[model samples]
Target: MKFKNLLLSWKYPSILLLGIGISNFGAWVYFIALNLIVLDLTNSALAVAGLYIVKPIAALFTNVWAGSVIDRINKRNLMVALDLFRAVFIALLPLTSSIWVIYSVVFVINMAGAMFGTTSRSYITKLIPIEQRKRFNSLRSLIDSGAFLVGPAIAGILFLIGTPILAIYINAVALFLSGIITLFMPNLEKDRSLEQSDSSLSWKIIKQDWAIVLNFSRQYSYIMFMHFLFSCMMVMATAIDSQEAAFAKAVLFLTDTDYGFLVSIAGAGIIVGALVNTMIVSKIQISFLIGLGSLFVSVGYIIYSFSSSFSIAALGFFIIAFSLAFANTGYQTFYQNNIPVEIMGRVGSVFGLLEACLIIITTTIVGVSAQFISIQFVVITGSIIMFALTILLFILSMKPSKSRYYSVKSVEAKDL
Candidate 1:
């Protein structure tokens, strides 16, 4: 479907897309300012790194039972509440000069973010039809990439005009605006029957919800395995990302402006890829979309790991970012289509918890390994691991996935 046609077909989806885009802008701006604050406060690279870990740590705890709460509540309300919650905390951030208080506020905001993510996905799955998910996801990818690209540039301008504190205040205002926009979207409350039957919103239900998710997992091993592989991809990507600036400057001898140009090209690549996907996604099989995109991204990173020239490295960045749009859209479509709609919140929270923990664990291992091993060797290993995993997933896609709820063959036959 054409992008214009897609937008015209839905009212709430467009609103949601615009809201999320704005939210992402706020998030990226806040992230940049927060990292700067940490570095300025402690004058320690380790402390800044420590601050990065705070989100994952908070997710590890919040995601354990977030599904329980998400399933029982109004998703729209939850999203708005989370946005307002985050806005309040973020607005309060500049009031304190204490590094510890900043950390505490950041952690709370991150927790709200984690819950928002799982709940929003569940809400989207319910609101958007299965056939249109690929398109919606592609649009989301486009907005997210565009937001990341624009947000930092805007933040930098704010810093130039005033201070990083000004950027934080701007983000808080953005969050507030996002919340107000969300209030205008379609009011999609859960089915009254489902909500009535669902367990009450309480901590005691967390254990029960987890058991439900575990049983659900056993019934759908293929889905869980794919999720695990995706987790690995995420971890490897994070590991490579952590060392990206260092490799770009220290190893490739690129100047700061050169690295900035490379990043801009990568962002442009993502937008281009998403644009292309919107045009071609309806004709492509999702398994091919995912498997081939994964292969493409892995190959790009492998090229990056070995490249000695700026031009070649820039090509790697383009390839990775471009294919990443496809991979992300494919995975999101797969996730939304296969999972039972009612249990989406619970299963998603479980997956989030697992992915968040794995990311931290893998990143820590890579960081420590870099201390003794050659950084180049560590990076190459991550690239190879990504390649191997993608290759395995591609091989597995030779036949239809074992998922009872959705199949690659069904995806092809339905033309969705």
Candidate 2:
């Protein structure tokens, strides 16, 4: 796509994207700063993991309600309210030094964030046309990835200059600014007629009859399962890397800054991969691309397990980034094209809940496993699982019935 096409395509989504990106950046800043603070205060990996646990749990419960709320409410206003609510919770972080208080605030913030996420995704479907959804979704991912890339780098720099509290204060300011921008977005409301019936609350209307929502889950079951496994491998790698950091310093004589720089290289790779997806993969079939991407990622992680040099590890990180970008683009576009606009919120929320739950379990397992076995072993095992999933997906994709699940058939044909 040309630059003008990409820029013009975002005309309607620009403001919402900007607001969400700013808020996401703030969220990551707070996440990194909070983890650092907790590590300093408690000196316990388990304690830090405890704080992380709040996010998935909050998302799991809040998403069901949030989906229903999104279906019934004004998308723009719901987002604004959620942004303001999250800003308040983030603002409270710097005022407390207690771990319990911090955990509570994190849970609350995640709850509100889940609501915002569901609404935001649903709203985007209404804002953009179906044919252009892939490009738009890719652009959105690029923006979000950019925020993640910049947030931690900036936080680290600010921490070096002042303190963790100072970086946190900056994060709060970013959220406030995000909320302000959200207030200016155009009003985008849902169809009230579908939401107002008394029967809307009944189980059939809320859950059963919505084939759009149901199919989104059922059709992509294999892909989602693979993602869950991939998440586990990622967590295993992260845990290993964390433990290996000190080893690098003591054994290989590398500085902390060198390690940080290597991580930054991975972030750069993610950005590059996202850009490629938006530019090239938007017009292509998603399942084939995703399978190939998974293969790259699985192989990269497997190689990472055997790498003894920083350069080799960096190469592995780049492959992981490429795979993640490809998989995310394909999965997101598959949902956007296949699901009905009216129920996208509910469907997307359900997907989010499942994804969060898997990540939480996987991360926890990896964290706990580190106490017992070598991190290398854990990573290699995770890689094997991912590779196996990729092969399974590849085989499934070759089957007509299974392939149809990922195809974007018209509503009339889909009903048949």
Candidate 3:
């Protein structure tokens, strides 16, 4: 009876994680296949690089107004629609020969992806109970870590047996299956009114939503500051990561095979860390997870920045990748527990837009700086900056007075 009751409680969350896992695995397959396809067609590494640019560009275009629509819609149905939308577009990708056409399709797909991200976060927050959030998030992180390794291996197998185009179709199928699975989950807002309808989406309404997010930030200043600092840490990580290939080649003198092995080490670390995190998450405080996890991730980057050999770099990669699961799980729980479901969409989108902008700016700066200066110097500088930010995050997270922010009880959002 106890076992049955536990199974019943986890049924929906388990199903949701399954759908998320499928989608995440498919996304990785699509990413590798798309990069290969572009490289094969254009034979230009820069052309392949453009594929990375499309996602942030898409976010910039979509995120400004996506929240207004996400907050007012049926999140489950919208999630389903977005999955099908991406599936259709992904299915069509193999038929297109022009790189420009592929880019255009990918851009559209990414826009839908941005909206799906916010909608799913809000939906998950609504569906999961407060007390269960941390465990659920830890499980989700474990699934994501599994996907990180499995997705690439599956893509490689598909490439060996078939073409990259075949992998693309497989991803389309995966998205369709994910949509079907999502259909089985109950809708939390089935009877709730859409107070902020899509029909009211406009400059004025978007401005109001911005104001609402700003007002929330003011009321919950510490929370938003933590969010901002976390974003800064991620931005610096991105900037430093942009130089990874160059640093590996120029500084460490690593061959392609060596770099591949290094990545595999990181994958191993992720799986091991996630397994441990899952088993021990209930015993650890959410604040410590966010604080220590983030601080260690930066420490790992600092290690990598100063490494002279492949083994040292691999250790750095392992540490950062391992810490990622904890930091991600902690932040997800914190965001869901604190942000009211009513305004979560807007808050996520607004903050997402800021993060995207920072990514672009920071990446460009890092890239240009590497061209002019040593990649090692640029990477180390960025990592040091990240370390500083995480230290501040760690200090703030340990404050006894601020422990309320990480509590299991949800905080109410102020009215706009």
Number of the top candidate by TM-score? 3
The whole-model lDDT of each prediction reads 0.83, 0.69, 0.92
lDDT of 3 by residue, 1-416 (tens): 99999999999999999999999999999999999999999999999989888998899999899998888888888898899999999999999899999999999999999999999999999899998999999999999999999999999999999999999999999999999999999977685443435466789999998998999999889888998898898889878887888999999999999998998999999999899999999999999999999999999999999999998999999999999889888888888988889999999999999999999999999999999988999999999999999999999999999999888778875432
Which has the better TM-score: candidate 2, or candidate 3?
Answer: 3
lDDT of 1 at 1: 69
Which portions of model 2 show Cα errors greater than 4 Å?
Answer: 1-9, 43-45, 190-258, 398-416
For model 3 the TM-score comes to: 0.98
Candidate 1 lDDT score relative to the true structure = 0.83
lDDT of 2 by residue, 339-412 (tens): 56666677667767777777666766765675587555665666676667666655554566656646754233
Clashing pairs in 3: none
Model 1 segments beyond 4 Å from truth? 1-8, 190-198, 201-204, 401-416
Residue by residue across 42-73, what tens digits does model 1's lDDT show?
89888888888998999998988788878777
Q: What is the lDDT of residue 182 in candidate 3?
A: 94
Error of 3 at 119 (Å): 0.5
Q: Identify the runs in model 3 with alpha carbons over 4 angstroms from their true place.
A: 192-199, 414-416
What is the RMSD, in Å, between candidate 1 and the native fold over all Cα?
3.7
- Candidate 1: residue 95 Cα off by (Å): 0.4
Give the TM-score (vs. native) of candidate 1: 0.92
